[model samples]
Target chain A: MSAVASMRDSILRADTRLSKYHPLSRILFYDDFDEGVNGWCELVGNHAGNLDDIREIARDFRPPQLSSCTFFDIGTHGSIEGTYSLKLATRAVPNHAAIAIKRLTYMRRGLVQFETYFTFKAEQTFDRAALSGWDGNKAPSERQFGDFSFSNDICDGENGKRYMGLVRYLNTDVDGNLVQKWMHKTSVQPTTRMERQGVVPPNQDFHTVNPDDWEEIPGGNQPLCFNETASKVNWHYLKWIMDTSRRRMVELQCNDNVMDLSSIEVPVYDGHYHGLPNLLNFLLDVRTRTNVRNFLYLDSVLVSVDW
Target chain B: MLRRSFTAVLEKNSTFTSDFATEPYEAGWALEARWFVRILEISPGAGLTMTAQISPDGLFWCDEESGPFCLNEVGLASMPLRNFGQWLRLDARLSGKNPHVKVLIYLAVKG
Candidate 1:
């Protein structure tokens, strides 16, 4: 490395928080939940004045919360660095999803990287039937948790093509069976305009046109550390990089596993979108497969870019 | 630094004919909270009782110290809460013959 670049790297390595993340040349934003939500808000559907006009699937994504990671067993688990983390929580109802989004507009996009330390859990339940066959190590509550995803909505400019790139960690299937795989959507997400025009049916999964339009990534069957209980919280590090110039994902890193996602296809919109020039939005969502609330918590986030 | 404050829409244009509770919200960092209920439409002679509920965890809940607020017509009502532990929600019970109410609920918190 050059002398100037090496000096910059040494400075970043001295900082405790920034040292954990590998960022690009220029840092855009660093959001720590201890300082509040930091512009993370609930993702709602498009509606003109009337709330009833919103599609049923996109109406109630639920509000984002600043959670202390407290549980019934433990008083306060706290976050990785602070007492709070930005949290998205789904309802106890099956198929319910909660989404939180951060809106931004790119200045000059080349390579953008998003990094965070996150964790997921299913709400503690008192139902005795779910714990019938406890193996003493693997918690039954692990199956109650569903899946969580990180996605983005980006548009080049006015009359430019728009697309969403998403990656999901499938924790359990609808029947409470463990899938434990990383997957990507094979189809584009249906928009409200598409539903209004009858181009697509009302969606059950928000990420794709059909609920089954997802495929497992190659060599992606990796089980995360659920810590064998509902109350215990273990944070995992995730870093994803995307190339705006090429409109493709570069790679994804979670914990110690790094997956090359350069060959994966990102479904783009058929037509151009207006009123969204240089649109860049990041989203985090959690979905419950069973009748138990699922939660995704982000202790902190750092977005950097190579421009 | 100035205090941090936020307002969340718990229910938006939601119509209910039976008893229901809003989703649980975490506000452990907030020192005070308020609930605003806006009744957009209600059946004639239909009314509902709204109560503020608190939870130690997000799972189990109990009623707050403030008494329930009852509304019988189209209007707006609000309730203030303090000393609520961490989680907050609103439970509403519809009353009268085949009663139904369409309303909007907002929760504001500050710390």
Candidate 2:
């Protein structure tokens, strides 16, 4: 309790918005997918294989490990009561498992916040393999998957540029200390390359900004790894705030802790000829299988506009 | 914003094209809106071409892009409709060898 209090005290009053604004829209259609994946569409060509992997878990299926976290409470209180959470996994083939809400039109540049609860199953453990190719048994060295953003024009086909909404990528360094990066696409354009058309090469039509170019989200030096560890099994609550009108990430909060990322610019669509994400869509991508048996549970998701 | 979603199925070896329009709005409003497209499900190794064309009068239509965007996976794709037109429809052609697949597309505009 004292630790949570200290974390709260550290976040300046100006950076906090949990209590001020009420949720205007859930944003995530079929929020819990209780409607049986009706409003969601898959992007992976292996749709049959991917669809089967996206399942739903009943509410009260697991205790709320994140009850003590303020951000967690904000999302739960704002979401549809007693709704089922999503269980997305990268099972069977190694391809990423993902689903996006069908409604795409939404204001990208606005005062908005996205909150959700995600955690690894108790049986799962970390397995660091190479970055390029998947090792049959383990995930790539860079565990940079989940919560993708092709929904916006950041993936404009013409320039092969990507303007992502939110990307959570985590990995461990040589010293075994957990290293994580949170990224969002700003209006800044990357140097263009050849556009060969459909499913072109990596950087061809979809320019992935260099890791160094991405704004860094500050995480305390403590090791925050999600695996078999009992304490870490608790749900990790995440919150993202953006002022699309200003085109920048206003702030980001993990659990009760808030960090000011006001310097990070939000992606602009002024010169993006291919188009931009006019819709507020979300997706899940588990690019690698954590273990022979493992699952990722999403307790809840809430999106609101305050301003 | 006014947002609506539509679903259609492309049977095996068949082509499907359906028309959907933006929520009818007053003049100069639709021009400020944008449209997003997502192909929900396509059978394995299925080659489906998904295209969005615009019509000012709903009689004559033109391709939104140079060629139809091919779908082989599950993900989100979008296009800005600064002044594209009033009516838009999806044109999908399925690769006969693959099984039938369902398509889910969403349209959103500023309220």
Candidate 3:
């Protein structure tokens, strides 16, 4: 383990504290059918207005990929500011079969105002040393950042020799019981494939021939964590198998955004207008905030696709 | 297409009246801007009227220049004349304390 000693010789105390900040609110998933001008779009809950956390009942979780997932808890008859958005990059993924699969769950807020669906897929040769276990090798900051921002390094090294991703905005609605579901498909399974993946070491000596069996890599606080970040680090590899299965999963989310409009505190009112005289009091084409919204369930299985 | 119901004040602006001349002023520029009109609350009595005026050199006005185009209906309306310059001024002109009007018009070319 001499190679492991050199990297940790000088441990520079590092403080990577994440500051407290606010996340932007997203408005997706809703049925804007009736409620002409002003109305509430709340995805009401069942029973005594109490929300139940039944994960076991939520059979259709999203794809089992190890992508970062966030859950938001919202309220009824009020407003909420979400700190996340669905990050599914549909265009980049490849569905050799007609259908794709993913695991998903409702994190927060139900019966939302609207929702955008996206799909993503990626694959790497088990032999690509430039890649392979890079997810565990790269700084946690970069990996998490790739989930939302444009810092995706999935295919940075190789031009177009990879496939990995998620798609978003599958479905949406305004008011009613909201549910969150994962992507699923029922088709022929792809053949099995394997690879001889390896780990990079700071000190070749400590990483290579330290017959002590499991020799620790020489590094104080390395950004990349080998051994610990496995293919199934948290059911990540399960996603691989899930995608290859003929029967996939379905996921859904619900929010509380649709309003009852009548409940709105209308400060001033001159009764309802009909004819040409009704050309006042409208805030049209202006992006405005709403009362509530939520995510709904995956209505059905994706039986077909064009691309 | 979802639309909101609201109310706005439609006021009458400066009017004009002018006669046509042979020298002919540059009869260029058409009207084209579709400012959305909010219908907060309406009744059967009210009407939307667009006013315009005729100009000689655009400096002079006449009885042939100014008049009103009643929208006839009670909902939203779009008033844009191809030869908007044939008239001098109207209320549809986008200028005032709260210049919130959009008129979309296309004019013909002179041979």
Q: Which candidate is the best by lDDT?
A: 1
Quality of candidate 3 docking, DockQ: 0.02
Off by over 4 Å in 1: none
Per-residue lDDT for A123-208 in model 3, tens only?
11123453555555442212211111000001112122111212112111112111112211111111011001122222111111
Candidate 1 vs 3: which has more lDDT: 1
Give a tens-digit lDDT track for model 2, residues A131-247: 336544343322433222222222333453334455444333223334554544432323222222222222311213333344445652223345323123355676666655554
1 or 2, greater by TM-score: 1
* Error at A99, model 2, angstroms: 5.5
TM-score of model 3 vs. true structure: 0.15
Q: How far is candidate 2 from the true structure (C-alpha RMSD, Å)?
A: 17.1
Q: Mind giving the per-residue lDDT tens digits that candidate 1 earns over A1-307?
A: 9999999999999999899999899999999999988999999999999999999999898889999999988789999887999999998899999999999999886898999999999998898887888888999889999999999999997788888888899999888899999898999999988999999999999989999999987767889999999999999999988888788988888898888889999999988777888999999999999888999999999999997
Instruction: Specify the highest-DockQ model's number.
Output: 1
- Across B1-111, the per-residue lDDT of candidate 1 in tens digits comes to 999998998898999999999999999999999999999999998889999999999889999999899999899999999999999999999998998999999999999
Docking class of 1: high
The local distance difference test score of each candidate is 0.92, 0.40, 0.20
The regions of model 3 sitting more than 4 angstroms off are: A1-164, A167-307, B1-111
Give the DockQ (C-alpha) for candidate 1.
0.83
C-alpha RMSD in Å of predicted model 3 compared with the true structure: 29.2
lDDT for A32 in candidate 2 is 41
lDDT of 3 by residue, B65-91 (tens): 325554423345443334443323333
TM-score of every prediction relative to native = 0.98, 0.43, 0.15
Q: Could you give the candidate ranking by lDDT, starting with the highest?
A: 1, 2, 3
